[model samples]
Target chain A: MLKIHGIARSRAFRCIWAAEEAGLPYEVVPLGFAPGFKLERPLAINPNNKIPALEDGDLVLFESLAINLHIAAKAGAPLMPTGDDASRVMQWTLWTGTEVEAHVMRWGYNAYIKPEAERIASEAAAGKEALDLRLAVLERELAQRPYLVGNGFTVADLNLACVLYGPWLNGYDLAPFPKVKAWLDTCLTRPAALRARKLREG
Target chain B: MLKIHGIARSRAFRCIWAAEEAGLPYEVVPLGFAPGFKLERPLAINPNNKIPALEDGDLVLFESLAINLHIAAKAGAPLMPTGDDASRVMQWTLWTGTEVEAHVMRWGYNAYIKPEAERIASEAAAGKEALDLRLAVLERELAQRPYLVGNGFTVADLNLACVLYGPWLNGYDLAPFPKVKAWLDTCLTRPAALRARKLREG
Candidate 1:
């Protein structure tokens, strides 16, 4: 059985969601952010000491997006497209990480993660503005098509949806981008995502 | 023929290097950073108006690593590994972007891209420190092997080498991590990278 390290509350949730979507059996190692946890097992797997490290046979891998992509690829077919469509899927996946996720992280850290005294209103506002701009791009694209890549859902949607979950939970307004809002609604409600969300919340 | 838009000096160079490595015939659209350039053709393909967008037949894609991976996959074997090895390749590729490249971008922006008046010495110092820490990871990993994945060069090395190139050019010292320095030297010397570097310098 494949094993995943890290709590679902972290980016590891995406890996769990991917496993569920792929119908692959997986065991969660469940590392937490609690005191003394950082220097423990997670570090042994990932030098970065970040959540969401994966183990399969002799292979140990970190990075939630890579883990998700690997699971999707293993499952094959509709979960991971082929040829030109695969290129588009990769495009959206990378875009979500590089473009969308950074702004979300910025806004989220300021709005929730950072201590009140350290939070800068101006920086948070700028992050929100940047996020809105990126969201507008997604809104335009989603308005034209239901899914990010092909006519059906894939790991691209799963990865992107997980990134957006942060902003949504942080109470970022989704009103300006109705299509993106709808897309998120559709994505988050999927059985796999719902199971992952329950596991994360627990 | 495949088309890659953006100057070789930008992330687009990775796509060019990958195409050269894959032995795929490609054309360069040659975009510049001049004002108003962002609102033009680049936006038509990539809503973010970022360089390094790709067009192959009816498909359009962006994100340098993704483009490189796509090219390598199309080329197959040695350049792109399969199965568990492919997972490790993806892990390293994503790690380069999220961890290594961010610090490089930070230092580069402060050391070169930002105007001297706007540059922050403290932030640049922090970036350098962060970069050193990340490079240590690579140094330790590379000390064990010549390539990032498998026994030979792969897209993982190509992507990572391109990410490191910016910092290397900006005079970031590689002496502290001899293994990483040697690995990078090996990666950058490939004919494809040599061609890409020449195009970028011109």
Candidate 2:
């Protein structure tokens, strides 16, 4: 009953993980930003022409994290905890976008997108250092709790996990942060989260 | 009373503008993401040490746009319009973050932060192109409707207007996009918007 339009490898991963975690049945229309008839269709749904545009009944929203949070909130489930802890939960999601995700993009671009001759060794090094520092913050925060939001799992953890795991796919290591490594183990063990990853990876 | 921490030049401008537009009275605390006392405060509201945090009673939140949307929704006197037309309004806000704000950061960094001689002329040119493309999109979208939604001004317009106008401070121009310029003129010139900008820039 919901329509999600985006390619799996793009920002759409956030929404895919979110939908699977929420147990919501939805259709995935694999589309991206490049010019094409299909891309035009998603653009109609999202004027900005961004990925992971969602249509739920009459409601439509874009912005990868916003879509995830919306699904988690509307599902009225534990993927997003409620009450006094709610703001902090939201804080984590925003943290990834503001801090971790920014560095991930820089590092990911350097590792893959930038031409070898054009790559800036210093920028990549700086990005890696910043990423590790961020993970250290996360490591300390996650050490006291099973998930990013405390004893229960939420979209916040899932969002961060996706970013942490992405760099590893390209050969970055997570061994330096024991707590983050363990947190990743706990997050991957979730049936729903794994299911979502399986579908995306497939 | 609500408390918002951050300066007018910061992203906190969005949160403060939303509070004012919603007619919600708030107090502003001078804060910027820099080394100082605010970062040392234990049980600090923001874990990443970023700014533009809001405290209403015990409900604390950060991320300027998120706080804006949250405030708008709760104010029933929302800055967003109603009905199916509302999605278009929503789209504008997302575009602000994805397009206008993004390119602003790009050129802003190059023109202001990036050291001269090291700054790539291509990046600055790309910023010009991005500004043109974004303004053109805004022009086409705004031409069809009086506001981003319909005839009513919403927070969507406010957010985009704030972002679109930033390049002006850096001496960047938007002279070609008459429609966008007119739309900003109407939206930003309003009493509420003027007041909010005054408070933010005051």
Candidate 3:
């Protein structure tokens, strides 16, 4: 059996959603985000001490996107597709992490996670501006396609939805990018994503 | 022939390096980084208006790491091992983008890319500190092995080395992490990377 370390409330939700989409049985190690969490057992599997590390027999892997991709590929889920579609899936997944997630995290930390006095207004504003630009790109793209890759939902959607969850939670308005907002709503309502959301909320 | 957009001096270098490593013949579109560059031809392929978008037949892909992985896997290069080794390669590539690259980009922007008058010293310092912590993690891991995954060079090393190039150009000291410094030296010296570097310089 595969074991995933980290709570679903973190980036680990992406992995759990992928697992659910692939119908893979996985056990969660239940790591949290409290202070001093880095010095705990998560370090044993991930040197970065970040959440969503995966252990499969002799192999250990960290990085939530990598873990989700591996699970989707292993299960031959529609979430991954194949060939050129697979490349698009990879493109969106990587893009979500590089171009979007970082900004979302910045906004999240400043707008919600950090103490009121510790939060930097300028940084949070810059994060919001950057995220708006990126979301506009998504808006244009989503206007032409129903999903990120091909016709149906894939791991790319799962990853993007989870990353956007942070911005959504921060109460950032999604109205400007109607397509993106609609697409996100559709993605979040998937049976698998709903189940993952329940687990995360719990 | 495959086409890669953007100048070799940018993130496209990673894709070029991967192609060279895989012995794949490719063409360069020679995009530039200027104020209106984003609204130009790059947007036709990448909605994000980012460089390093790839075109192969009817398929288009963006994200340097994703492009590199597709080329490596397609060409069956030593740059991407098989099975479990491939998973490790994926883990490190994604880790490079999420952990190391972001901090390096932060430092690069504040220290070099931004005008001196606009640069924020505190943010640059924070970036440097974050990079130090991440590099320490790499140093510990590299002390046990010559490469990021498997016994030989892989696309993972190529991706990591390219990301570290920004820090190297910004004159961040690597002496404190001898193992990481040594590993980076080896990866950058590969014939493929050498060719890519030359192209980037031109």
Candidate 4:
């Protein structure tokens, strides 16, 4: 049995979706229980003390994206890439964590988390600008291809899609990005994605 | 010829060090005028317009740690773990990006980048608090082991070290962290690490 730590409303959701997609049974260890709860035991597995810790037998790993990669790898399915592009897949995955994710979190924190009175317009604008820049790059890459890597979907596309979902749900429109919008549509069409939505709707 | 795009002081140093450590023959395509510039280049390799994009033949990769991992993969040296621990290695490497890197960047912005007048006491304290928490966790982790993964140095150590170095230079006393300080000593003891320091000095 595998154990996962973190609330579903977090980056951990992606890991849960990944585990479900892989048909692997997993236990969701709640990090936020009471009002102010956040990563207590989960931090033991990961020094960062964030969320989405995965424990498989004697091995424990943290970081949502890394957990997704681990599960995808163990399942041995469509989640991973083939041939020499394995590292390329890994490269894009980390890129999402750096470029897309960093910006998205900034925007989300400012626009939604911070009270309107406390939120700085410049910070929000910077977040928007940063996300826009990232989307534009995504638009270009996803324009010619169905996914981030190739004709078919891979883990890179899945992870990137999840990152984009943050800003989109936070009220940032994706209307201008045709390629990105279309790519999102394709990702949403996946059976696993539908299940991911159902799991996240709470 | 492999062309790595990034400035010296940026996370690109990871790639710079990795290539040198891997003995990968490549050229440095320095972006940003000097050190610590966060400007972006539009519609190119990096969407967010950041430094440290790696262009190897036709494949273009960005994100410093990712590029470093790609280089490490090719070199297949003792720098990274092999076989079963590979993904585990990836997990820790990404953890550095997710936790240590972001937290330390906050501290750096306060110390060096932010104008003294604009520097808020609260912001610095908040940043310091976050760094203290993360570093405490790191110190605890290091107390148990020599490196982040397995018994050897990997990109996990490299990425975290580079990101955390900024804070250390800004006067966060590392003397009390016997485990962390000892581990840092071991890491910097490497000839490659010594050479990387030279690059920084120059």
**Residue A36 in model 1: shift from native, Å?**
9.4
lDDT by candidate, in order shown:
0.86, 0.72, 0.84, 0.74
- List model 1 lDDT by residue over B1-202, tens digit each: 8899887767888899999999999998877574445426537878778888889888788888999888999899989999998888888888877788878888888888898999998888889999999898888788878888978999999989999998876778888998988888888888888998998776
Pairwise TM-score winner, candidates 1 and 3: 1
Q: DockQ for each candidate?
A: 0.77, 0.28, 0.76, 0.58
Model 3 clashing residue pairs (backbone): none
Interface RMSD of each: 1.1, 3.8, 1.0, 1.7
* Cα RMSD over interface residues, candidate 3: 1.0
Instruction: Please say which candidate is ahead in DockQ: 1 or 2.
Output: 1
User: What would the per-residue lDDT of candidate 1 be over residues A44-84, giving only the tens digit for each residue?
Assistant: 88877788899988988998998998999999989999988
Query: For model 3, how does the per-residue alpha-carbon lDDT over B17-122 read when each residue is reduced to its tens digit?
Result: 8888999899988776743454375467777777888999998898999898888888874777877787788788888878888889788888888899999998
- Per-residue lDDT of candidate 3, residues A1-202 (tens digit): 7798888767888888888889989988877674445437537778887777899888899999888888887887477788888888878888887898889978888998889999999889989899999998899889889999998988888878888976765688898999998898898888888899898776
Per-residue lDDT of A191 in model 1: 88
lDDT of 2 at A134: 88
What TM value does chain A in model 1 reach? 0.94
Judging by TM-score against the true structure, name the best candidate: 1
* Estimated TM-score for each candidate: 0.95, 0.80, 0.92, 0.86
TM-score of chain B of each: 0.94, 0.83, 0.93, 0.88
**Per-residue lDDT of candidate 2, residues B92-142 (tens digit):** 554565456767777777776578877877887888887777777677776
Candidate 4 clashing pairs?
B5-B52, B6-B52, B40-B49, B41-B49
lDDT of 4 by residue, A1-202 (tens): 7788776777777887787778888888777543576447545766666777888888888878888878877776466765447677787888788767878877877788668888777887888898887788788777667777766777777778777776656677788898888788777657877776776665
